[model samples]
Target: MRKLTLLFSILLVSLVSAQTLQDSITFNPQQQLNAAQRILSGNYGKAVTVGAYGEVTYNQPEALNGELDIQRLVLLFGYKFNEKTQFVTEVEFEHVQEVFIEQAFVNYNVAPNVNLRGGLMLVPFGIINEFHEPTTFNGVERPSVDNVIVPTTWREIGFGVSGKLNNLSLGYQAYVFNGFQSTSFDGEGGVNGVLKGSNGLRSGRQKAIQSTIDSPTLSMKLDYYGISGLRLGLSGYFGDTQAEDDVEEIDGANIGISMIGLDARYAYQRFTARGQYVHGSLSGTEDYNNLTGKDLGSELQGWYLEAAYNLLPQEKTQRLFAFARYEQYDTHAGTDGALARNDAYNRNDLTTGLSYHLAPGVVLKGDYQFRDNAVSGGEVANRLNFGIGVWF
Candidate 1:
């Protein structure tokens, strides 16, 4: 199996490289969209670029939690079909065993300020959802708020448009796509509530290979960066998650989901700060819970704030930063049905860490976490973590 996988990977890389070389000659350094335009126009020199990233972690509780791991590895491919059209995709391996098509999309330059794209694409919800890239953020792991609220790494089979108002430093992305299936809403496999613990919305991702469209979802994002090193944005998502499936007296499960989020990032001198807030609700969840015999919440929320400063501000090749973050989230707020919301459902976490940069895209991190859960005795989950991450 391993040998076959290796052979397949080698063949895939060769195919992409050969195609890119035949279509384009150069690769201009810029954003994905701009690069797509140049590649499609046959103006770039490089046929393709290949890179990967990985993170390894060690924890205080070495027996069950602490171990070496390849959190993720990715192979990115970009190709130009013509002057106005291009294609890009990301094939990712998770935990070294699972493979997925993280992204696969085609782009068309419709105008100076607009581009249209379709296929499997990331959902732009918060800072980390679309631009995670590991090296882009601080700490060994992504923020907790992103996990339960905005839900990073969220993608779907969809069609969308994106463009920028360069003069105003404003950008926008909006899309319409197929939504979640009620079948992924079963009550087993450690899934809790009318939805799922892993995110009732995220678990149902059709992943682009095959998608169910009984329910359609709409998502939009508006971002601004008028000031140097300062960014602000707002995003929203709405959809009917249940897909109107045929289930006896389960009409109530055919519910609606609405979510809104706000995020900000700013940097000045050697100091930096970031924050994000998200809130959402599901309609008909109360009745839906009764019909499914699961405890699902109607209201969900998450938020986080972080600050960091470079200790070696004058160093050009290396940097040491001290950072702290606070996060809060509730996955079971306003749970419907007979099962009341567990106090432990609301969680607060504080993390303090030091990150040392050995070079651009290479970092080592150490952190200690303080945790507080509304449920009794939940504080025992605190631990210390150390990790290294790199990308090229």
Candidate 2:
């Protein structure tokens, strides 16, 4: 603990010095180093940083299995073209077998207050949607509501402008990307119901791999961070979901999908709180259900609230923190007809955990998850999980 405190003091002092240097950069950019130049003085304005993190877990519920696996491995590549432009990309390996290009974009600092960014990018909605590096958030597993509603790691092909004025931050991104593919919809339970409203809208992702698009979608996000320790946001998505032109349509009817989200975060001293709510609606579901014979829900919604506190005071390096979270979500909030909404669609989650950080971006995680649903003959899924993650 003594060593940790000393390290934190040194870091704090360095940060103050850096801030002072930043204030001086504006007066003499041609002769002095900015934040980026200080890090790579002889690299010809080109620089790259790499990071990797993963999780291993065990679950004991009924006869469920325990497994140790590399959950996520990633490499981030960045290059500065000049003072105004840079290229960034993230190459990811999931479960060690799945490969994904999570992000690839070029950001241009057009002015002191405005910037333009383009290419495949992560959508900004809830807190986790964009800044979900493991060390940055609480809990061994991410909040279920974010996974099912806001859809963590959600990315698409598009471009937009991001800017800030004093305390207010604003961003606009419009993506022309393939909408959900209807083929992925199924009425299964436990993570398979991405389109069927049983597991939310996850499986519908096209991931830009030989994707098909009949009508592309437009997604937008607007957020604020105008106050210290407080953040507020709103985001939405709209598009036609029909992936095939030849699918049989009832009276020339098809479904257009829409989703809206609201989220907030606040912290005071040692106490921190965060929450998010997202709701989705589907159009022409009755006709589409009749034609496809798949029990698809027209409505989906989910929400979660979390709070945490640190055990050490005025310390930023190493400290243990306790947290608790409550989550409720239903991918199948409502159905078309004749079929009642599946009880399994609704889930209630309670989690309590402790996180200990050895460094700012490296930590050990442990948590217990208690999950309940109204499914007939289905046992409640409650388990304990622990893991470690890092970022730099």
Highest lDDT model number: 1
Give a tens-digit lDDT track for model 1, residues 1-392. 99758946875776566533322111111221222232344336454544445677776742346666777876656666665677877778788888888878888889987999998888889888765665567777788788766666788888889988999888999998776654433435322233553354555556765665676799999988777777888999998873433442255555678999999888776787889998988787777666656556777888999998889955365777799999988877666656577677688889899988777667899988887878876554676888887754
Q: What's the lDDT of the predicted structure labeled candidate 1? A: 0.70
| Candidate 1 residue pairs in backbone clash | 25-44, 25-45, 26-44, 26-45, 26-46, 27-45, 193-295, 194-296
lDDT tens digits by residue: candidate 2, 1-392: 69546845754654443321112211111132212222323224334433334555444554578766667866555566787777767777788688798877777888886668787777666668765667667888888888876677777766777655655454444455556666432334211212555655676676666665777677777766656667777888888764444442333235668999888877776777888899989876676666556567888899999888888774455767799999999878877767578888788899999988777557788888888986877778688888787654
lDDT, residue 66, candidate 2:
71
Model 2 bad stretches (over 4 Å): 1-46, 167-176, 184-194, 248-254, 376-378
Give model 1's TM-score versus the native structure. Answer: 0.85
Clash count in backbone of candidate 2: 0
